[model samples]
Target: MMHEPIKGNPLPSRAQAYKTVAVIGAGSWGTALAATLARAGVSTRIWGRDESVIEEINAHHTSEKFLPDVTLPDNLMGVRELSGALAGAEAALIVVPSRSIRSVARQVAEYAPDGMPVAICAKGIEAETGYLMTQVAEEELGNRPVGCVSGPTFAREAALGHLTAATVAFTFSQADRLKPHESPAVRLAVSLSTESFRAYVSDDLVGVEIGGAVKNVIAIACGMMTGAGFAENTRAALITRGLDELKALAEALGGRRETVTGLSGVGDLTLTCSSTTSRNMALGMQLGQGIPRDNCFDGKPVVVEGEVNAKSVTDLARRLNVDMPICETVRAILHDGKGVGDGFAQLWARPIEAEPRAMDLSFDHPASDKDIATLAERIS
Candidate 1:
């Protein structure tokens, strides 16, 4: 039962133009966004590694298996091969899961032409390599104008026409045929609002990228608090204090404190920690509810970005001499089998003092500038 999306949101009168945008991968995030761009009438094409899924989307105009219930426009084209998708595409939105990014990049490098923009949309830390996804992007897609898209966004919400926000930051460029994308695709672009949904791009891509990964670990700790039935005051205290530990690690990794403050950092942290949707939080809750560790993720796509990131962040924290107790606690809970109550108690017994000495950078950068939101949040 697929029908047209009610068409309430005003269509972009910009002649519904997309020179050529190809989305890589056909997972929920990739599929949802492909539908969004197609609905916006962008000359959009999506590349899926799975041949069966590609056939379904191309023939049905709906990605029923992964993103059921959403209707894709007839204009949307699906291809089983990457070379076909990359041909003539102005931009390629890379949406493969974090772990698979490197392999996919190698594939992309084989055919990706020179000077095109690649938007790295999927999130996570590469457990094996420890390099952020963008780092791999650079290695695989050499010198091609690069930008990163991140923030507290889920595939389903953004797909359902819920007002959603994200950040897609890139360096200033000057080249013909690649005249910096005068505007971003309409489905999700950078804009600010104190209410509803908004996204803003930043030049502090490393900082923003690190913040997105590090916060997932703390969200797991917050989930543990929910499982413990701690008071609201306790949860708030955990989040703020956990953020300090997170900030220290972020600075050590060359990420600005302000980047951690915006959507990917504080914003994403709040969304994942406080909500039932977060698999990391949900895992913590189940552990609190006495579910056995082996039984937790059986036959499910339960990915706790923090679970893997805890190790990465912890390693980075130790390397840089930063203190991060909450993160360590999560590691202990998941790996050492330390009781959740013990972990929480250990956190509370620690010392309280004046805000620890932290690095300071000049504030007051124009949000109009790329690094504005990321910098402001860190310097606060």
Candidate 2:
């Protein structure tokens, strides 16, 4: 049942939509998604291990622990038991932190009804395996159709009914893979989209997920620059170069370059790097303000994804032979305990190169006076 307003655009009717969607986390993102889904008229149930948060959502339609200022939808139900959340749900959206996703996926595998489509909304590479979130979901939830929901979304803003867009990417040929059945991508996308929340569908699942993961790491670098009093030009340079790195990594991982230029790529990158509301960027700001790594967290209760993404992104880049200096430098500062100033210095000291469509040209431009002098000193 496709609702085609135009020849190419297909929309799903209310009768075709999934009646119940199980949101597998109670954190900010999860709550926001649950609220959005409920507002869109879908029956949504949010699951969390914290019984208190569940009670709060059920009784007051608020999630103070995560979204302190926002009130959730009245119809959005909260459940503590995994089985109860998944009992009659047609889809499950995993919004837990990446570190805990595998465990959650394991639970879903055991509890979720067979053939329910799973969408991963969290954005980060798995630290232990360096696998993308979609890959992790696919591995853990064997034979199930997997998809990704990611973009430049902030939980608070989206919860406030602000205009937002995201990429809804499912694996290509999913119907064929499922064999003798309909693919959930279109139905899921239509069901998730609303007046304020728009969903752009694609098949480049890897590229979309890559943009979500790498942008967090880049946002940290941009935050550090801001914290250190760097001007806008420096931030722009970093953002542009970060795009190059993202494209390189995406291509290496078999994703399309155009995907890196889409909403999930440049759009998400710009929003994350420019805003302090992002947890990763905020963490970078603290580090850039000369705060010790140990003291950066102080009182924040959030899991800053960039902290873990730095290591996983850099490791994956190295394994794929992709050049991502900004991400590498972030990993050094965050994991190697390298000083921020020194890291920036090393980044600025690298030789300049020409840009191309692929940005892969390795030829260095004319050597700087400093380089020439250093070379001369070595020769002498």
Candidate whose lDDT is highest: 2
Runs with alpha carbons beyond 4 Å of true place in candidate 1: 1-18, 173-198, 297-301, 356-380
How well does candidate 2 score on lDDT at residue 2? 22
lDDT of 1 by residue, 1-380 (tens): 11232356443433223567889989888987776676655677889878888888888877777778877668889987899999988778888877778888778878787877787875666766667778878788886766677778777776667787777666443331133235432222422121344557565667777767777887788777777666578668877887787677667767778878888778777777787677777887777666676777663656566788888777767767887888888888887877776666655555544565533333332234334334323222
Clashing pairs in 2: none
In model 2, state the lDDT of residue 73.
87
Residue pairs that clash (backbone atoms under 3 angstroms), model 1:
257-378, 258-374, 258-377, 258-378, 259-374
TM-scores for all candidates?
A: 0.80, 0.90
lDDT of 1 at 241: 80
- How would you encode candidate 2's per-residue C-alpha lDDT over 5-92 as one tens digit per residue? 3455353433256789999999899999889999989999999989999999999989888899897888999998999999988998
Q: Residue 115 deviation, candidate 2, in Å?
A: 1.0
